[model samples]
Target chain A: MEPFIRLTAVAAPLLTPNINTDVLIRVEPMIKVPKGKLGPYCFEAWRYLPDRSENPDFILNKPAYRSAKILLAGLNFGCGSSREPAVWALADMGFRCIIAPGFGDIFFNNCFQSGMLPIVMPVETVEKLAKLAQSQGDLAPDFTVDLERQVIVTPSGEDIAFRIDALKRRALLDGLDDIGVTLAAKAKIDAFQANDLAQRPWIYRY
Target chain B: MAASTLFEKIWTSHVISDLGDGFALLHVDRHILHDLNAMKSLVELRERGYAVRNPELTIATPDHGVSTLPGRNIDTVPEGAALLRGYLEETRRAGIRSFDMNEDGQGIVHVIGPELGLTQPGTLFVCGDSHTCTHGGLGALGFGTGRSEVIHVLATQSIYQKKPKQMRINFNGTPGKGVTAKDLILYLIGQIGADGGNGHAVEYAGSAINAMSVEGRLTICNLSIEFGAKVGMIGPDDTAYDYLHGRRFSPAGANWDRAIAHWKTLPTDAGAKFDREIDVNVANVGPQITWGTSPQHVISVNDVVPDPATAGDAARRDAMNGALDYMGLTPGQPIAGTPIDWVFIGSCTNSRISDLREAGAIARGRKVKPGVSAWVVPGSQQVKQQAEAEGLHEVFKQAGFEWREPGCSMCLAANGELMPRGQRSVSTTNRNFEGRQGPGARTHLASPSMAAAAAIEGAITDVRKMMV
Candidate 1:
């Protein structure tokens, strides 16, 4: 999981701004009990009406979004409660990259840790991309995010740059988290601990 | 250089090591627990056949899943009650101090912790519940944690974590009449858009914060997490010391002298740098309400629901439209005059004695409106007892509001009680999310007095008129 690393070919873009974790996955789908069955319920509630009728109005119900892995959304895409279930539901639903202008802090952290990429583009750009994808009909809409370049290459061959923290980007590229990074430096930490414990006897017990 | 605000003093005392990249391994002094999240860890421990290593460092209470309706044993619901009972049973088995159902000490963990002195200044507090930041109102460093961290804290009494950067939020200008700590927080959350405090500990200073009583400060600090803040604190002054002087666990005599002297040194230094700082002009704040699924979707009572075209960003605009659609609210209507079917005044957020007194003051002689049901629930047993002694319950009953026992009643509909579907309520609780108060039960966040005024008018009414 390199920061902004991972390039994939996408079909028509799906745009939904501020899609709460709730929409990413319904509560029932995540009820993540029964061990690991988190994927199928991604849009359970939205897909069906109260009478279990198929909801034709839902985004996933549309042909374009059904296979669109590249979600181009507006600003503050995930600004709400810190429910990690939303992220799990999104990842399980086959969305790898959520391109938006902003996201809630907790939701953002959850996205990175779960191997999902949240690419933030300005509002003007997201609006342009969304309208283009919406009107393109059968046109193949896609973008490539080169972690090495920190740039998103649109289907029109235009490159859009984004910003990411250097260290987090490194960790994502290396498939590492805070704990993973810490463990990588275990030997150094161990040696430092041995020396520090002798100097500050009360601080180190384990 | 050592201190300029109560926040700096607490941070310095707890800073074990400054790990690189804006993180610290601060010492944790107290860890609190409740039913919903502890179950996750209990399930794991039961699978591995592990025992808790330290019980003295932990505390448990059953507030989230219990029925607030009196005389109904929690066992009525086999699974939910069993899970709650299991939490209490395990806490007892582990020799952890528990404020369980049928125990006088039983109450919301945040409420009782302060009253009983389990929460104190310059200590770190962690809980499985996000609102645990409510403890920070007492000048302690409190935050919520995940299940894995819960296990770590139970096993070693200390969990590994890096510290967050600090922020100072100054509430300048005077809070207009009827503005409260609850309203201040709701307005602040609205301004920050729910995630503005990400990766930071916010400390409130300025005239408005200084004017708030200890209890008022507690209410303001409790909702820090709603804005993604890890900690929210206010400087400990005479007001703080006065609140803690003789609590059940507060240091005695000689130790008290030492503690007070140390507490006096709590405050941010004049030149200390913060990761971020926000200044809210309290003068502009007014009666606030939640119009959407998040606390950030708030506006002053006089303001109208925002049209998507006028929203700050496309995402925000879309969210506003979605919120309006789900809430059945018109875009340009005044929030102040919206009709309400119920008024709820309780929850970990604003269910203290002061909260009740304010509500009771509004309900003193007025009866609830026809077709409207209102509730006046204190946050803890002690709060209830204090309110009862002051005859606040009589005022509520006289005003046609239900006087319920202490429990997390109606805050979440986990208890058998609920607001009927499609009924709108003015609630003093923290959340207005879909079904947070009850399934399809609309909730608008407001101060206790405002809740009382709504109970009387059966609509969202301004409390300034009702204020004595």
Candidate 2:
């Protein structure tokens, strides 16, 4: 969409694994869309996202290091519940890259659709990347992920090989997502809908 | 040949088209929304100037952010309160039936549907909440949805979905004295692992299911998502009909007769086939809790967590080690008496009036431990009101518990009440994954009575003795 969504940044270490979408983003925040407003609430809110007028201490506001485009996470990231707002929050917040050892079944799909590259690596690789990112803020711990090479290169010239499903790899490389996939089958879908409705009039009356 | 199961009958019956690759254009009959997802759909409606295709088909309620602390009816939580108020105003303006906290008609969306008899046999019920499957206890097809699908349903009253395969989970034999429906479902999760139902719609049947009460069936179906099912159901029966007999929105005198007649024929045929069938012995299940992240990483309170070396599968061992490290629990240690600092017994999953009553029975004359902080919250203002009328509030308050108003409190701490970072809690809510309660808060999922007993003991303890 943006000529290739590449997020070069210092890694923000998120040690927690199996983070549900609700934790990474939030349902209450996604519902209050005034248009592309989720970037602020990506990790915000201890309670519900406070009224835009009221200031609240959100999780993303902690004083350690802020505004990370690259998130280095522990194994089994984005697990537990299947709330999708987490993906929206991260993508909307300009975080286009996430490196983790594993992802939940549903959250993984949700992330791919939003153009967030969820790179799978060994747990030790993620741990090493997290350590590199935490120590060097604004140091630009370079992770230039070359799809052709299928490797993410670090600032220190270390190469991290990543794995992605062949189908998902094509979807990402071609930028063909859910909407594109659905629209590609539009003709077939229309004919099927017509025929099925003709056959089952009672079910398709609506 | 594979035989068509009850799920196949209902699912295929509703299909308008096969979109290929397991996707289908099935029809949704009744669409429901809560405060959050409803508003997103409303904005989309105003943008396209689309009038709802069928207003009567949609139901809206303020459950997720509805205030639970009684008398403090004022909006306290910022975004949730204002958003809920906006949902009430807009839905009322649109001529849609909207339930607020003050409405005796209001409660958790799933709790209200069956109680009011709006959830009926052979219907397609969809909401924006995961536990929408709770309605399937009455032979309806119910499940959660995404924001985009919510928008589609809001505009056209129809949404496209993939048809899931069928699975029938049958529990036979008499449950022991301490065993409840929650125990059965938890034990099932432990057996099947988290992704077990990833592509199935489960139908719970057999003798043990027949013995479960309406409330118990709701609890069972409520956790179907934990096993990865798109939906879960129990065929409508006398128990479901009886529970729905005289609620505010239930079918009245004449409609009741018609409803019952229709519900009577909704059961599966003797030869109905399932894509998969699993059997459980109700007698073997006991009070269960998660010692690790995945619900499958569970054990009986009296048993120790299995060592990784003893794990049968590589994935199980990996999950076991991961959960143990995150939860700070060691392998082979007794989970019972693993001291907890807090106990919270309320959520959409188990915050109904019946759950409160069960906890009340357990808490009668028992003082909570001196250091433990515990609270009992109803699912809805109506549940709160009913509990008060039944003197269940006194039962909770007399047991050194805080009787709080109902919204999803501490369930995710989205309401401002937290279990503090790194503290452990015995909760009646679903999921025990890390930071599910707070940044580092540890959660132990349990039945409401078990939660009450843990609150009293300040640790994991068997709930059977407190039953009497």
Q: Which structure among the candidates has the greatest DockQ?
A: 1
Over B323-402, each residue of candidate 2 has an lDDT whose tens digit, in order, gives 77767888778898899999998887798888998889888888999899989988876788789999999988998999
A157 Cα displacement, candidate 1 (Å): 7.6
Q: Give, for candidate 1 chain B, the lowest lDDT window spanning 10 residues.
A: B155-164
Q: Per-residue alpha-carbon lDDT of model 1 for B1-468, expressed as tens digits?
A: 343555666665555455666545455677877765555566565565556654665778877667666565778545477668677667777777888776777788788888887787776788765677788777787876644556655654444454567889999988898988899999999988676786678888889888788889889988887777757887777888889888877767666786777666666667778878889999989988887777888888778877678875655676677778767798878888889898899998899999999899999999999999898777888898899899999999998999987777777655656788678999998878665665467889889988999999998888898886
DockQ, candidate no. 1: 0.17
- Cα error, candidate 1, residue B194 (Å): 3.0
**Candidate 2, which segments miss by more than 4 Å at Cα?**
A1-19, A26-82, A93-206, B1-3, B308-322
Candidate 1 residues lying further than 4 Å off, grouped into runs, are A1-35, A38-48, A52-54, A67-83, A91-100, A109-206, B1-9, B12-18, B45-53, B155-165, B303-306
Interface root-mean-square deviation for each candidate? 5.9, 5.8
The whole-model lDDT of each prediction reads: 0.72, 0.72
Alpha carbon lDDT of residue B185, candidate 1?
Answer: 92
Q: lDDT score, residue A204, model 2? A: 33
